[model samples]
Target: MADPKGFMRHARREWPRRPVGERVKDWDEVYVPGGVLPFVEQQAERCMDCGVPFCHEACPLGNLVPEWNDLVSRADWHAAAERLHATNNFPEFTGRLCPAPCEAGCVLAINQPAVTIKNVEAAVADRVWADGLAPPRPPERLSGKSVGVVGSGPAGLAAAQQLTRAGHTVVVYERDDRPGGLLRYGIPAFKMEKAQLERRLAQLRAEGTRFRTSTAVGRDIGAARLRARHDAVVLAVGATAWRELPVPGRALAGVVQAMEYLPPANRVCEGDLDVSPLSAAGKHVVIVGGGDTGADCLGTAVREGAASVTQVDIRVLPPAERDEAVDPWPVYPTVHRVSPAHEEAGELRFAQDPDADARLFAASALRFSGDGAGRVRAVHLGGVDARRRPVPGAERTLRADLVLLALGFEGPEVAAGGAVAELGVAVTRDGTVARDEEYATDVPGVYAAGDAGRGQSLVVWAIAEGRAVAAAVDRHLMGATSLPSPVTASTRPLRA
Candidate 1:
């Protein structure tokens, strides 16, 4: 242990966010730059370093949490970065985007507040880059094998980088004009700057991973042609078939899908556009979902100067703290989470809720009313009970000039002539590509990973899948692999 009584000596101090008033005016990340470095060592010292270390198991990547915490506490950043990179491909992405289920499973969380695992992780990742500890590891010998990765999201990128480092010629194909997939377009700059992504991309390029952008595998190039060109093909296409809210006025002019709204705003930040065509400036926005994507929309809308913003969640409000009876120790619990966007919305008093939060819990949208020009004007809502049954006399209405459906995704999008269909991969009833425990598809020499095989999930899970699938592919080609396989296809989270 870094300090035997460290847990007793230190109190959890989370990373501080910039002032709400100041942060909302720009697209920079909410956290104050270099703010955690001073207190991060103390926070790292708080790791109890338990015998079993549930935090390690809770992570999808099986990250060495306690070990790295000790390394960071001792200020051995080089050793800490080495340990951090042992299992995870992109700590910067997960440190910023992951919800950190590992923290929820922290041994200290069983009693007192959890250690600042996420904050320490973010600090270590940033330090690695600042100190130039991370460098490309180009393979010393060529394996004479080639692999084609379809997608440029977290999973595809991770797989390509690992395969490249393992001496295989790897080419990643992306439908977008640029790489990074959702990291480049779906996520806003305020959450994680695109520069972080570019840095990693540069490292991958230096390590011999080639990228082919604006090339949809199933559309631009035939699946058979791709397979003929490469010895193996790995599908990392993420879940893009968004869920729909088929309510009244679904086709109204002002109503749009969350994916439709977020990308344009990101493009504006990329300087491709002066302003988002669907800008929420001076408009009342209603987001119909309560997931991370919805929170993303809430923040983007707030930054765009929305007149008012309200998020509608179908489930009831979660408890302030974890309910041990429902979710025991080491299991991810359901609790109220206040993201930076929520804080900004609360500070601005943009919500009409009694608690002044931007969310409306246990509410369902019944219909939408439109203006004479086919634009949405209002949303009709009704309260629901535990069983999702409507409550009597709880009907209400809210004015809404813009409606964003953040209702999540179904599965991988298998368009009429997409790669999935051309490759003859079978899709499961859950809408994901059918795969064995080894991530092998029905077709020989073809594999599936990430959301394409596991359904929509967190970024941590996507990276884990990417790494695991690479190992599987390597083993198939070389008859053995020294690469680490963190998780399998059947692996499930310790959730309630």
Candidate 2:
């Protein structure tokens, strides 16, 4: 236990965010610089260290939450980072992007606010980086076996790193010019700066994890050739087939997929583009879908100087507070919480309409209206009843010069699954690659991980899948593995 009375002594508080007016003007991270460290110890002390420690169970990586909380409270930054890395390969990524289901399962959440585990995690990661503790650990001897990973996202990165350290030669293949798959493109810069990602990549490179960028295993080179060059292959390709709104005016010029809109903006941040090709400047932007992707689009639109930003959610607003009856302790709850982007958007719109949340709950899109030149002009939407049926007389039109469909991905595409066929693996009916509990495909010497096998999932889960697959591959080659397998491929959320 951190402190017997620490939960009551200190209230749960998170890192401070920069002023909305100041932050929206730039693409830097939304939080204030060096803000989390001062109070990180205080927040870490709030952990009760329950007998069961549900937070660890909730996390896919099985992070040492209680141990690190105690370490942070005791002012041991190096030990905290060591414990965090014991399970997770990239705490920095999860700290910024993950929804923190571990916090939802916190023992304190039963009666009080959850501990600031995510913030503490970020602080510990940053502390280690600042302390120059991220030196590369090259393998003592070569294992002779080699692996070719087909993605450079979190999962692929994790597998590559683990295999490299386990004395195997690992090469990560990425189709994009840069190594990081979605992390380098899909996410907006305001959420997480690329410097954090670059530094980690530097560590991986120092550790001898080779990255082959702009190389498509299935298209540029044959997958069979790659298999022959390497002992095994691990598919960590993410679920990137963006879903569409199949309605009238589907081909409007201004209406684009969320991937199309976000990647260009990120490219501009990467210095590849002077201006984003899909700039939202001076346009009325409407983002459909209330998930993190929609929030990302909203934030990017706001930074790009959109005139107005509106978000549409198919489901109604979640409860203001956790409902113990429906979602008990240790299960992630449905609660209305304002993300950093939402806060900035709310501030942007507060002057015009104090009550406007810029979100239309339970709203279903009917179709998009296009101008004579085939550019999106407006979006027609209607409210839905409890059963998701259209409500009578609830139709409304919103001005939308730029419409970004943030509806989540539809798993991997067959074209993207080109490597799967070359390796002779089976895909599930739900559009994901089929693998058994060991992440092993029907074909020998080939396996799958991340969204390719698990469908759309969190970054933490992808890393976990990567680690598990690395273990499976290591054992397959060395006849035994010393790596820790945190979760099996069949693991599911406590509550759907």
Candidate 3:
């Protein structure tokens, strides 16, 4: 356990981010490099190591939060990394990307600020690499069984790693030219550098996990062929079918999905492209969604020198603090968050909002107007009440040379001749692949996990599903297995 009085002695201090002025000029991550290391030990000390640690339950991965916090506080980096890795395959990704509901479930957060769990986790992840503590651990023996995993995202990668380490020959298939599904393309460089992903991929390769890039299972290789070649097949295909905004002028030029915009921008960073064709340079951008994806677009546009960027959310503004009565301790709450991108947007005053941020809450886009060139020129918006009914006389318009619809995703892309369609897998009414609690689909010797099975969710959840599905596969193959199953297909977050 950490210091008993540490919470009282120290207030929560977050990892310092680079100044907005400098960060917006380039795509480097917003955090000050090595900033967390200086104070992370003290932050870790704030963990109460509660009698009933709810942080574990709050996290979909069921990461051993208190144990790692205690290890980090004791300056035991190796032990902390091991503890973190026991459940989460890629703490580096989660440390940077996860929203950390674990912090909201912290006992200290009942009245005081929660410990900087994310910061400590990230610091330990960095140390694992810097200290050479994460050398490839290839299995000593081979199981002689082979498995094919579709998609190379967090879930696919996690399942591949666990199965490979379990002595099974694992091959991960990726549709993109490169391995990482969203990690390499959908996510921007500023949020998490590609270098971090590359290092992990290198380790996986050394650990006997094979990757077949640019191979779409249903198209490049038939699903039947893949299943015939492997003893078992795991589908970690992610939810990527983006939801559309069926408003006027949606077909206009410069009106695109968030996936379309983000990937090109990331390609630019990967040196595959000199510049993003959809770059927001000098354009007045209107991103119609206030989720993380919208903020990502806002930041990317700001860095691209957009004339202005406004993020519109149909939902009303969340409270600054959790309403304890409605959202009690140990349950994730709805609260306002100021991401680094929001800070940059606020500092630049790129959008006109009374709160000095880029967000425009409780507002719905009514329509989009296009110019003579068929390019979007402006977006018409209207205020909506709690019931999403339009408020009278509350309509307005904003110039929008470019509009990104970050309206989230519906489910996996089960297009005609896609993996799901070709495999004849059962799909739920929710559009996700139908699977049992063990993550097995109706088809024999085939299983589904991650976003494909769980629907659109967090990175932590994807990794958890990956680990859980791997255990199920291993057990089915060897009659019994030793892999950890942190979650079930039916498991949901402990949030209100």
- Candidate 1 regions exceeding 4 Å error are none
lDDT of 1 by residue, 1-496 (tens): 8998998999899888999999999999999998999989889999988999999889999999999999999999999999999999999999999999999999999899998888899999999999999999999998999999999999999999999999999999998989998899999999999999999999999999999999987689998899999999999989989999988889889999999999999999999999999999999999999999999999999999999999999889999988889988889888899999999998899875645679999999999999899999999999998689999998889899999999999889877787788788999999999999999999999999999999999999999999999999999999999999999999999876
Candidate-wise lDDT, in order? 0.93, 0.88, 0.92
Q: Model 1 shows how many backbone clashes?
A: 0
Sorting all predicted structures by lDDT, with the top scorer first, yields 1, 3, 2
Q: Candidate 2, 35: how far from true, in Å? A: 0.4
Give one digit per residue, the lDDT tens place, for model 3 in 1-496: 7699999888899999998999888888899999999889999999999999989889988889999999999999989999998988899999999999999888889899998898899999999999998999899999999999999999999999999999999999898999888999988889999999999999999999999998987789998899999999998989998999998899999999999999999999989999899999999999999899999999999999999899999988889999888798889898889888889998889985545888888899999999898989999999998689999998989899999999999889998888888788999999999999999999999999999988999999999999999999999999999999999999988856
Order the candidate numbers by TM-score, best to worst: 1, 3, 2
In model 3, the runs with Cα more than 4 Å from the true position are: 352-355
TM-score of each: 0.99, 0.98, 0.99
Clashing pairs in 3: none
